[model samples]
Target chain A: MQDVTITINGDIVTGTIDERTLLLDFIRDVAGKTGTHNGCLEARCGCCSVEVEGDIVKSCNVLALQVAGRSVTTIEGLSKERLRPVEHVTSQSLAGMYAPLEAMGADVNDLHPVQVAFHQCHALQCGFCTPGMVMVMKNYLEENPEPTRDDVRTAIAGNLCRCTGYQHIVDAGMMAAETMRSQPDNSRPAPARPAHDH
Target chain B: MRAFTYLTPSAPTEVVEMLDAHAPDARVIAGGQNLLLGMKDRSDSPAFLVSLGGVSELEGVRAADSGELVIGAATTYATLARMEFTGWHAEIASVCGNLADRPVRTMGTIGGAACAADPRYDIPALVTGVGASLEVLSAQGVRTIEPSDFFLEGGGTSLQPGDLLTAVRFPATEAFTTVVFEKFRQRVFDAALASTVLALRVGDGVIEDLRLTVGATTPRPTVCVTSTAGLIGQPVDAIEPVLVADAAAIEVLGPETSNDPPHLRYQRELIKSVTRRALIRATAIPRS
Candidate 1:
């Protein structure tokens, strides 16, 4: 066993790992942070991606000891215990636009406009691929306030979503970007914008 | 991957001590991407993996006051790709920049690439194009060897166990030189089926110097310095014909002779194209 010290999300943790232990196994099994899920054990999928020393890298292939003193940021580290609602207007006008699976996943009694657009466009069929898809879309939209369908496609290439055929998902992402950009801050509804809100 | 002992030594003396202690079973890990991949496959396992990352003296990119371009062996390809290069060397830098992906470029270091001597890699031939000489650190201290003289047959280098490649130095040249690199690969960012780099020095409206290098179609890429000598002082009209004639000299040195391998034809075409481009660049720019 080797002693390893690394930051998980925001906490500094130190532990001993077997010589053969991999970082993905340590994070999921030892730390029990399931937010970092596993896909292909090989390097093809980005589901195991985490930021190590500021560079995006696959965790499955990295040995635990390799990051002995490095800072690693996984999906679990993105926010506080409660997400602040940054609601805005134009959340309805673009609801008539392309499909967004995340928006539709929300119940109608508490629907987000992004979800409404997904239902209107029928963006999601089998929701099995939704989590990774939403994360991919969220990551892309955060970087690109405006993206072409091709840009959306390239951003999502490393991710696999056999369900929904991808065309509708691409449409959903573009529509969400347009909606988010056009919205004005005071237009937010007084209620909580569900924690799952994008 | 099997468990292996890891070590990172700060001093060259300590590195030699570790190499002496580990002996033949020791393997140096620069960027674990390739070495660890092999370990994962259970292909070739080492008892120890010594990381050269801690050796600060082996990391640099300096055109020394002597005009020699001295690059530390552990320097990443990305660093070299972004550096200023003139003459025929630009082709080498550009080829390296686009070597693997941007990630691979950032991860893999030149010392590992050259020492691996795998014909599938591009930089080995590029180093030959620049006439760079290598420095290796071992228990015996340091020794220098030119790339051509240092490569072994069957696409491996002359590196021995416990010997760490230290740095590579390219002799200085003034303006009036040019290098053109041409590669033929089936896909973008894929390994080249055939690759060539041509370095030339032009003077008095004629070719004054040349270095011809070809890769990926042989056990180890061969340098055709003989054919290059024929190009010195040759005018533009005779340069192209000389290259075409030199193609006959580039035959695989080992057992895989099948009338005409696609690799061989592609190799010749790469030589022709790179040479043609390098000549055009050299005469136009005038690198001394």
Candidate 2:
């Protein structure tokens, strides 16, 4: 066992964990951030993706101790305000459900453009893969701001989405790229919130 | 994953000592992209994990005084992909960026891939085809192993428990005027089922040096040295890709057997196709 101190979404999470504890478990169990999903225990699924020292890696494939003293940014760190959970966001009402971001007091500016694009493009159906897709797309766009649609498709090739057939996801990626290119200063997510002392 | 003790050594020599002290029970974890997966499945459960991430000497790429490209074992695929390389060396970057996915590449190291020595991985094939050497450090001190000896016949590597692969050294670009790697996989992110690499050097309109390697289909990357040696002095334009590929396929797969499995036959076909493609591309490219 080892004591790992990781800065997660701007929060310093310290835990004495088994040496085999994965970063996915460290984030969801230790850091209490469920925004990062645990789709596959193996590295095949991208659901466990998160940023470590500015590079995205599948958290499930990394031991928590491997990143003992590093800073990690999860989906939760992508915005200033978290969108309040709506009971059921149906496709029929999805068009009318733009108020959740506003109702949660999150302006369009507060959320990462990728998140906004995913919502606008209806990029997700089950939403199990949305967080990973958004994280990867955001990371990819930051590097290649002028990516073509084919480039966006190739960028998210590792991320699997059973629903939406990936067409809308690719559309969202292109939209996000255009949005990011227009606003260079907003390329990276806003500085993470200050750590909450526990 | 079974519980283990995680050890982080900041220097290459320190890692060697740690591995030496804990031989047979300790395993080095570079990117953990491959090791952690095995651990999760209980296929690998070492008592200790020596992480090479913090080891400064085992990271990054540099040009050796001898003009060889020395790539630190811990350098991630993301670093190699984003780098700007010149001439045929750029194919290394291309292979790095194009494999797996962005996130996996960010954490997978070339050394880890070589150390893992998985048959389906592209690194072993490319390294073997280019005749690169592996730098290994053990209790006895550092020594270089040729790719032919470093990689085993079937799967896995020749590295021992106490051995740490420090870097992979590629011959100078002038050694191989052009290099091409081709592979076939069902999905973009899937490991190659069959892969081929062709590294060629031409001088005075004749083939001076030719190295053709077939991987994935074989248990280990097999260099068709005897089969390709015949093409060394052949005129560059007279070399027929189909004839060369057929010879290489036969060399690696051996003579067709009456009861050869359907998959074996399919793999032979794949080897022929990818090899043909690589040879065609290698011959057509304008040599520097």
Candidate 3:
């Protein structure tokens, strides 16, 4: 067993797990955060996607022991920030990113724009792939606030959705992009993340 | 997946010592994209898994005194994609960015991909095309292996049992050159059926130096020396992508001793078309 400490959902958590425990298992079992679903167990399905050190990764592929001293963000934490819409935050705070959602007329009371766009565009049929898609797009749209339809397709190409034919997902991503870019440049600071997190 | 003990060493020397202590039972894991997949399939079940993530020596891209870009074996493709490189290495960035998807690219390392020696992988051929070499270390000593001698059959490298791949060094190229990589897959994230990497230098309207490598058609990254030789002395105006493609395809698929003739024939056709497309795209890049 290895003693590991990881920051999840902006809180530091520590645990001792088998060397072979995968991050997906640690998130679902140890952290009791089942929002990050596991579909293929393998990395092929994007359902296990999460943010590790500010980059999107498949939790299933990363061993729990490898995530020591790193920061991880699951769908649960991401959805919370989106729902709460933290307006005042540090330059690197992940929570501060949602300020643009307000500029795009995203309702703090309802689902995030990416989520709202998904529902409005019918991006999800069974909803199993929605969390991964949202996680991927949240990170993607933040980086590329103005994405073309082809750009959105390329961004989510890794995520495999067996339903909705991906046409709706692409549409939702573009719609989210429109709302994300509506904010003035001065209104947004650097991405809300700690400089040392990555 | 079978349970295995994990060991994380902070230095390369420690890694080799641990490898020496645990011979065939130890497996060095960087990124774990390929190694973990093999482990999951029960094809590889090492008693001890050595994680290279903690080794600071094997973790960044730097320039060597010899003007070669030494990329630490553990440097992720996601990092490589974000690097600002000019000329031929730009092609490398493009290849790294487009390989698999964002998640895999973020996790897969160039060293891991090269050491895995998967015939269908992009880095092996990309590194080979740019004349890169591997720096390997073990209990015995250290040595540099060229791309031609590095890759082994059946998704393995020349790395001996106790050896660790430290870094891959890419030699700097001349100006007036362009490199391009093209991969053909059924889907965006699927493995390549055939892949091509081309590095061409044209000067004074004449072809100067060219390195063309094709992957996924064979057990290793196949350098099209014969095809390259055909274009070396030719003028840029007289050269054609099809001419080089045909030579590369013929060289890859010899007419002798066929165990699986039909598969070889189909692959040969893929080699030609992919090579031609790669060459055309490469030659079209505006010379800087």
Candidate 4:
């Protein structure tokens, strides 16, 4: 066993974990941040993707002890407010059941551009893969402010989403790129477009 | 994953000392993208893991006085991709950036891939194709091993239990005029089913030197020196890619047998096609 301390979303999370403990487990179990989903324990699935010192990595593939004193940002860190959980959001009642970012108490300005774009474009269906997709997209858009459709596709190739067919996710990525490009200084969030009525 | 002791050493010498102390049961972790995966599956259960993350000396790229390029063992692929490389060395950057996904590239190091010695991985083949050497440090001393000797015959490395690979040294940039690497995979992020690396120098439109290496098909990346020997001194246009590729495939795979498995046959075909493509692409580049 080893004492590992890591900064998750600006909060210091220290745990006495086994040397074999994965960063994924450290985040979810120790830090209590379940936004970072656990998909395939293998690195093939990017559901465990998180930012370590501003660079994205599959947390599952990394050991907690390897990043003992590093700062990590998970899906929870992307925005100031969390959306209220909706057990089952079907297309029939999606409009009524899903509330807009503002209505859900999430400040539109606090959410990352990628998150805003995902909400606007309905990029997520079941939303199981949203955290990883959003994290990867946010990181990719920062590096490449002007990515083409194919570039967005390639950037998120590691992240898998069985739902939404990836068409809307790609659209959200392109939209987010435009928003990021327009704002040279991303300190302020992109203006929230009118929410999806349907 | 089994419980183990983790050691973080800041210097190469310290890493070797830790490995020396643990010997046989201790393993050095660089990037740990592949090592951790193996550990999770219980395929590898090292009692001690010596991490090279804090070793500043073993990170970044430097040029040796001999003009060879020395890349630190812990330098990640993302760093290589972002670097501005000149001439044929840019091929290395391209290969580094394109293979694997974005997140994996951020953490996967070239030295780690080479040490892992997985045939499906691209680094070993590219290193061998470019005629690079691996520098290793152990309690005994530091030594450089050529790729031919560094990589074992059947999908493993020749590194001993106490050995820690410190860096990969590439031949002088002037050695190869141009290099082209080609591979075939099922998906965008899948490892290469078969990959080929072709490096050559042409003087006045005639082949001066050529090196062809076929990877993934063989247990280790095999350099086709004899098969490509006939191409030397031949005009660039006179070389037939298909014929050269056929000779290389046969040389690497041996004569096709009726009892060969279906995957073996497929690999042979992949080897030929990728090698042929690499040759065509390499010859088409305008020589300075």
Compare the candidates by DockQ and give the number of the best one.
4
Residue B172 displacement in candidate 3 (angstroms): 0.4
Relative to the true interface, what fraction of contacts does candidate 4 keep?
Answer: 0.86
lDDT of 2 by residue, A6-95 (tens): 999888999988877889999999989998999977877799889998899989898888888999999999886666665556545654
Candidate 1, residue B190: Cα displacement in angstroms equals 2.1
Between candidates 2 and 4, the TM-score winner: 4
CAPRI grade, predicted model 1? incorrect
The candidate that wins on lDDT is: 4
lDDT of 4 by residue, A70-176 (tens): 99999998876555655555445665655645454557687788888898889988888899999999999999998999999999999999989998999899888
The runs of at least 3 residues in candidate 2 whose Cα sits more than 4 Å from the true structure, single-residue gaps closed, are A84-105, A187-198
TM-score of chain A of 2: 0.85
Per-residue lDDT tens digits for candidate 3, residues B106-181, read 8899899998888888888888777788999988888999887888755567888899999998877563288878
Per-candidate TM-score, chain A = 0.60, 0.85, 0.76, 0.89
Candidate lDDT scores, in order, read 0.64, 0.87, 0.80, 0.89
Q: What C-alpha RMSD does candidate 2 show over the true interface residues after superposing them?
A: 0.8
Evaluation by TM-score, superior candidate among 2 and 3: 2
Docking quality (DockQ) for each candidate: 0.19, 0.74, 0.59, 0.83
Q: For candidate 3, give fnat to 2 decimals.
A: 0.71
Model 1 stretches with alpha carbons more than 4 Å out? A31-49, A58-61, A75-198, B84-93, B173-176, B226-229, B241-258, B261-288
**Which ranking of candidates, highest lDDT first?**
4, 2, 3, 1
Question: Which order, best to worst by DockQ?
Answer: 4, 2, 3, 1
Query: Each model: TM-score of chain B?
Result: 0.87, 0.97, 0.93, 0.97
Task: Name the docking class for model 2.
Answer: medium
